[model samples]
Structure formats: C-alpha cells, structure tokens
Target chain A: MDSIMRVTVYIKIKPEVLDPQGTAIARALSDLGFAGINKVRQGKIIEIDLDKTNAIKAVSDTESMCERLLANTIIEDYSISIGE
Target chain B: MDSIMRVTVYIKIKPEVLDPQGTAIARALSDLGFAGINKVRQGKIIEIDLDKTNAIKAVSDTESMCERLLANTIIEDYSISIGE
Candidate 1:
C-alpha cells in the first residue's frame, strides 16, 4: 500500500516517579489563586509521520523507538497510537 | 454537586514558530537508524484533576488557566478537554 502513516506517542512519568515539573505547575497554579486544583501531571506528546504502509508495523516501530530513545522505561511509560 | 473532574490540556507550538526541539528529536531518531521518519513534532500534555462538578465551569476555568500560565499563547496553541 505504501501510504504515509501517522503515529502519536504519549510519554509520562510513572506514578511512582516524582515529577518535580508537575509539582511546580501545581504550585504555580495555586499561587495564581486558581482553586480546586487537586493534582497536575505533565507529559510529552510526540507526533511522527512515517513513510510506511502497514499499521501494525508502524505501531511496532513506534514502540521500539519509544523504548530506545523516546522514553526512559525505568521512570517513564509510553503508549503508541497509529493513524490518529 | 462536587465531583472530581479530569481535564487534559494539549499545548503545541505554533506552526510558524520553528521547533528546534522537534528538529533535534527527528535528528536523533534518524541517527538511531529508524528509517522513513519524515517529520516529528513535540508537544506537551497536562492532566489536571479539579474538584469541580460542572463541565462548563471546568472547561472555562481550564481555558483561563491555559491563557494565564499553562501555555505561551504567543508562540504556542493550547486545546483543553474535560472529563476525559
């Protein structure tokens, strides 16, 4: 088929991992006087366009990429989505 | 009615604003020997837990938060989703 495929990966710190950035944002919101903010978690979104045709291959490829460079598996978790 | 609402905010760089970080990511992916990576863009996902029950109020509050601090609207654009 050889149609260009689009992938989106979301990477976030594991719940067990402390996210200073998220904490900072929560604090900043509190400072700004915005009430009712119980928690804030920050994550990264990576959108990629691949010159591949197969959706399954694209998902596998994206997962490998996340394991290798996109995410730190020890403290971060990543999920890959294809064609969206 | 006071129920916890989860709000998700996605902030992305304005298309006109050059994304050096995204460029670096693409370059890194290329160096890692993954082929067919044509374009890459990086964005931020902020998950917020608010003690608000009204969906409309939560959305409006989130939009204001993005305008005030969560996003740099000058060079970035943000989208907010509630109860998801």
Candidate 2:
C-alpha cells in the first residue's frame, strides 16, 4: 500500500568545524543578560513525508537523501528518526 | 559542582505557516530521481550548554532562552530535551 509515512532528520555541524553562527547565539544570549550560558550550537531539522508505508524502506531512502543532499558529509553529521 | 550540562531545543514552524525551504528540498529530491516524496518541513535544533549540574534548573533556564530569543513565538513552537 502506498500510504504516507513520516521521517525526521537532524543535521549538525562537525565538532571540529567552527560554528560561528552558534557562537553568535551564545554571545547574543549573554548580551541579553542570560546567565549560566556556556555554548550554543544550532542545527537543521527536516521532517519528510514519503508515500511509503514500510518503515524500514523509509529510513533507507532517507539515509540516501542525507548522503545526497540533506547533509554535507564533509562538515556535517546527521541522524535519522523514523516512525513515532 | 558547576559542571556543564547539555540541553537541546527543537523549534518548528507552526503547521499553518508555509515553509518554502522545505518545499524546495522535496522538489530537489524529486528532480534528482527520488520518488514517493510527498511533503517536507524544516525546523531548528539548538544545543545549549549551561554551567549547571541540576537538570531541572537547566531546563527552566533554557525555556526562558526560548521564550526570550530562540523562538519567535508568533509563528513557531519549541520543545526542550535535557540530559542524555
């Protein structure tokens, strides 16, 4: 059955790679008088809808999507979550 | 002990709001020959480090950060996850 399924992908920059944007957020929070703040890193979250009911296949396809476009393997790391 | 703790914040656009970036990703995937794609939505993943050992206090402080700056409550919704 070609039913709809949902998959979520979380992408984050590599630890070694500098995250200036995230650093900026940390500074901004500090400027706003927020205390106890240390470091802040930001990433992208993508929720995809696929016309496939099989959970296993959905995850497989999503991994391909990540390897292809969803993430930059050179400087980013990605994790995939499927089903509820 | 003032050890560092990590808290993750997930911010997503309200369902009613349009997400062109997500839409573009879906279309791009289709053009690249990947099929069965229906829809896609994008969000933000913010990982915050705080100099607090208490998990409870960390979440509370992060929530304030969300309400104050991280999210634009008008068109977005955010959730927080703490510790492992």
Candidate 3:
C-alpha cells in the first residue's frame, strides 16, 4: 500500500519586497467601497501529493523541495503543512 | 482604538480545471531529483489587514472581497482564516 501524503506550502514575499499585485488588490478594494481594508499582500500556495507515508520524512522532503525549487528564499518565505 | 484583524484567504482551482503551472512545477521537481512527488497544485493566498476589530465582520468582509475580486468563483474555491 502506498502511504500517500498531502503537503500545503504557503509562500509570501518578504515585507520589504514590492508587491504590485497586492497594491493593485488594495486599490481595487478601495474602489469597491471596502475602505476598511488597510493592507493586502498576495502570496502563493503549492500543494504537493507525495508517495511517502512517513510524516516526518514527508515534511523534510517538502521543505527541501521548497528550498530548492518551490520558493525563492532570497525574497520569499514559506510555511509547510502535512495532511493525510 | 481601532481593532485591527488579519485574514488569510487560500484560493485553489477546481479539480476539473487544468493546472499548467502545477504540472510545470511537478516536472521541475522531478528534474531536481524529487521524483517521489506524485502531484502538485498551485494556488494563491491573499492576506488582508482590516481596521475592523470584530472577528465576525472581518471574516464576512473578507469573504465578500474574495467573491468580488480575490477569487474567480467560476473555476476556483477559496477558504478564509482570521488571525489576530
């Protein structure tokens, strides 16, 4: 039996980095009369389905994946969650 | 004092929607030696900072925003989480 696991990775640009999409979102919200919104930041979520069943190994692999290809560590930060 | 709240929204494509980016990511990962990864899905996260302190209102507003602009309901599903 294959021990399949799902991992969700959330990646966001560093605070200092300029996010044109986020700025555009905020402006659009204001135009839509949702003026209470103070700030908006846009990011990405990557969900990976893995064949590994071991929880610890899955997470470790996912993290390495993030470091190597999933995220740009110089300008973004990411978080990972493992699910059944 | 203004009650500020943070809301995180996760948006993903409908299962039936073709995800080229995800496919590309999976292929890239395979090229990088992470061949155990079976599938991948790519989505977006939008974090909003609201001036409204009430948790309920913050969530409601965020949902409305998602419907209006943050997400394309036609081919996507979104979930919202509120944080301090």
Candidate 4:
C-alpha cells in the first residue's frame, strides 16, 4: 500500500514588481492569434508529493511554507490546493 | 498613457521528482485543521511588466522567455495568464 498525496501551490507578485515577462507573454499570444488577451501575468504552480492521509494538514503546512520560504510574503501572495 | 501589460507565469514540478517541501506543507495543514487537504505542492509565480498594446506579442515573448531564461523547462512545467 502506498500512502501519498499531491498538492498545487499558486504564488504571484503583489501588483508591485514590474512584469516584463507578462508583457512578453501577451506579445506571444497575439502572434498566436489569441485575441482579446490584452494582458498577460505569470504565476507559479508548485506540485508537492507527500506521505500522509490528512489533507487539511497539508494545506496549512504548505501555506506556512509559502509564508516562510516558498514565497516572499512582502512582495508575493500565495494560494494552495491539495489533492491526490 | 501607459503602453504596458502584466503577465503571471506559474512554474511547477514535473510530477516525477519527489517533493519534500510538499510533504512538509501537508504536515503543517494537519496541525491547522484544514481537513481533506492531503498533499501540498509549491510553485513559483512571476509578474512581469511591459510596454506594448498588442497582447498577443506579449504572450509569445513571455513563453520564449520562460523557455530561455525565466523557467527551467526540464524538471518543471510553466503556464501563463494575462490581465490588466
């Protein structure tokens, strides 16, 4: 038997940093014919693997991780969703 | 007038590598009472700013940036989203 879980974390800028990457993406989309896609912002999605059963515990733990190490709380905000 | 755009890039694990960070998050969630949250994965979110109106171009440029510099496409995957 295998006891494991998977979760995804989303973290992004707090609307402060300059988004040059986003601008570049938006440009690419236009070249690709993705109309109406005026602006482009990029965020991070982290997938984690763990050995556990309690899902709630996972989210809270991840959130704290985001606050402490994963993300810069002063300039970035993060959200977590767990599953599998 | 600001001829600029914002894009968010989400970079995450490729589901093959073991995520120690995710495991730690799961453990933390259990302590916080976030029931059902079994796993937790952490990722990165990058916000970029650009000077342009053509959104399509922005996306393409950003994608290339991810492929070239912004993200490591080997053990990780990335997605882009656009907005004001």
Candidate 5:
C-alpha cells in the first residue's frame, strides 16, 4: 500500500502584476465602511493528496505539477509544502 | 501615524460542498501523466495591508470583512492571520 501525503501549493501573482480582484475587494471593503485598508492582493491555495511515501519525491512531483499546470509561472510564483 | 499590518485570509469550500474546480484540477493532473493523485481541493488567499496599530482591532475588522464579503460562509469556511 502506498503511503498518503498531503501537499499544499500556494500561488500568488507577481508583485509587478496588476490584480483586479484585489482592487475590487479593497473597494468593497471601503464601501462597507471598513477603513484604513491600504491594499489587497488575491492568490490561490491548492491542496492535493498524493499516494507516495518518499517526502523528497512528493515535493519534486508537486513542484512539477505547479510548473506545468497549477501555476502560471509567467505571472505567478508558487511554493509547495508536503505533510504526512 | 497608524502602523502597517499585513493580514492573510484563507477561504476554502466546506467538506460537504461539491467542488467542481477541485475535480477539474485532479483530472488535469491525471491527464498530465502524474498518477497516484487521490484528491484535490482549491481555495483562495486574500492578502490585505491595513493601516492600523492595534492587532486586536485589525483582526476583528478583518473578520468582519470576511463575513461580509471575503467569504461565502454558507458553503465556505475562512481563517485569518495578522502580521506586522
């Protein structure tokens, strides 16, 4: 039986990129009377369950997934974490 | 002058809720020839910069924001963290 591992990948837009969703969120907060909000940036978190035992291989595989599909490397940066 | 604080809010679908995005991600990973993937769940992260000195007030304000707009509490759950 393969050991199960949980992986978390966080993908965020590059600082130089403009995030419209973040802008909308900030405006909404202001409209709601929540003041003192300077800025807002939105990103995503993808959690995956993998049938693998080796921690090193799990991280490498997840990173590849992020590079290929999970994240748009051109405009976003992604980090991965693996857990038992 | 109000001090600056950074807040991160993570929103995820409730376990009982059907996650089509997650399903799509899983299928995509499989199509990419990466096997042994059991499940995938997708979520969002919103990073906010606040001009506030009091950490407690900042958290409360952020929580209110989450309840009002940041998250759809009926089908999603959200967690928040504040940092300097």
Candidate 6:
C-alpha cells in the first residue's frame, strides 16, 4: 500500500528585491481602472507529493525541505500546507 | 480615468524538465498515507494587475505578455485569467 500527501508552498521575493512583475501588475491595475492599489508582489507556488505514515510528520518534513532546499531563506519566505 | 484588472497565471514544467520538487512531493505523498496518487508536478502562480478600458483586451494582452515574457515557451506552459 502507498500513501500520498500534497504540499503547497508559496515563495515570494523579499521586499527589497525589486519586483518587476509586481510593478508591471501595478501599472496594469492603473490601466484597468482600479485605484488605491498601492503595490504588488509576485510569488511562486510549489506543490509536492510525499509518502509517510504520519500526516503530522510528513508536513514537518516538507517544511524542512522548503527551508533547506526549495527556498532561499536569505532572500525568500515561504508558507506550507499539507493535504490528502 | 483609471482602471484595474487582476490577472493570475499558472506556469508548469513541460513534463520533461526533471521536476525534483514534484518528485519530492510524490515521495511525501506515499509517506503521508495517501494511496494511488500517481504523479505530481510543481508549478507557479503569478498574480498581476492590469489597466485597460476593455476587459477583453486586457485578458488578451496579459496572455501575450505571458507568452513573450512571463513564461519560457520552450520548457513551460502558462494559463492566464482576468478579474476585478
């Protein structure tokens, strides 16, 4: 029998890392007619699958993977979630 | 006059990019007790703001932008959506 887990992580640039995508989006917003959209930032969402007997432990391991390999802690921050 | 539109683009590997993240997730899924989860591929979601008098045109422009700049057409594919 095999088990599966779905992990989604969102990674975004540090505020200081000039976000061209965000800027472009902001400009597009102004063009579209929405006002007061002061700023925008772009990010990435990564979904992973894992096998483990314990759901809690699997999530923890995925978090560690994010911290260790998936994201650069120095310039990026990430959020993680686990599901069936 | 100002306008605003929200655009979301999802980018994924072309199935041959050797997705280590997807591989990791698949392993995690088996560990977490989910059975029959065959394959997983990791991707990114980019949200943008656009300004245009016409919603239809805005969506089209966003799609072109995705093709020209946002995504690598050779190794990636993208989907775009527009909103308020």
Among these predictions, the greatest TM-score belongs to 5
Better candidate by DockQ, 1 or 5: 5
Error of 1 at A55 (Å): 0.5
lDDT of 3 by residue, A1-84 (tens): 557789999899999999899999999999999967878999999999999678898888888999999899999999999872
Best by lDDT: 5
**Winner on TM-score (2 vs 6):** 2
Q: Show what share of the native A-B interface contacts model 1 retains.
A: 0.88
Comparing 1 and 3 on lDDT, the stronger one? 1
Q: How would you order the candidates by DockQ, starting with the best?
A: 5, 1, 2, 3, 4, 6
Off by over 4 Å in 1: A1-3
Encode model 2's per-residue lDDT on A2-67: one tens digit a residue.
478889999999999999989999999999998878889999999999887678888888999999
TM-score of chain A of each: 0.93, 0.91, 0.88, 0.77, 0.93, 0.72
Q: Which candidate is the best by DockQ?
A: 5
The list of candidate 5 runs beyond 4 A from truth reads none
Write down the TM-score of every candidate. 0.94, 0.94, 0.92, 0.55, 0.95, 0.59
User: In model 1, how large is the Cα lDDT of residue B54?
Assistant: 85
lDDT per model vs. reference: 0.91, 0.91, 0.89, 0.68, 0.92, 0.69
How does the DockQ of candidate 6 come out? 0.21
For candidate 3, lDDT tens digit of each residue in B10-48?
Answer: 899999999999999999999989867889999999999
Over 4 Å off, model 4? A1-84, B31-34
DockQ of 1: 0.90
List, residue by residue over A1-84, the lDDT tens digit for candidate 5: 647789999999999999999999999999999999999999999999998668898899999999999999999999898872
Candidate 3 Cα errors over 4 Å, as ranges: none
Model 4 CA lDDT for position A24:
79
Report the C-alpha lDDT of model 4 over A1-84, residue by residue, as the tens digit: 667777677777676776676677667656765554554566666666656757787677667767766677877777777763
Prediction-by-prediction clash tally: 0, 0, 0, 62, 0, 39
Instruction: Please rank every candidate by TM-score, starting with the best.
Output: 5, 1, 2, 3, 6, 4
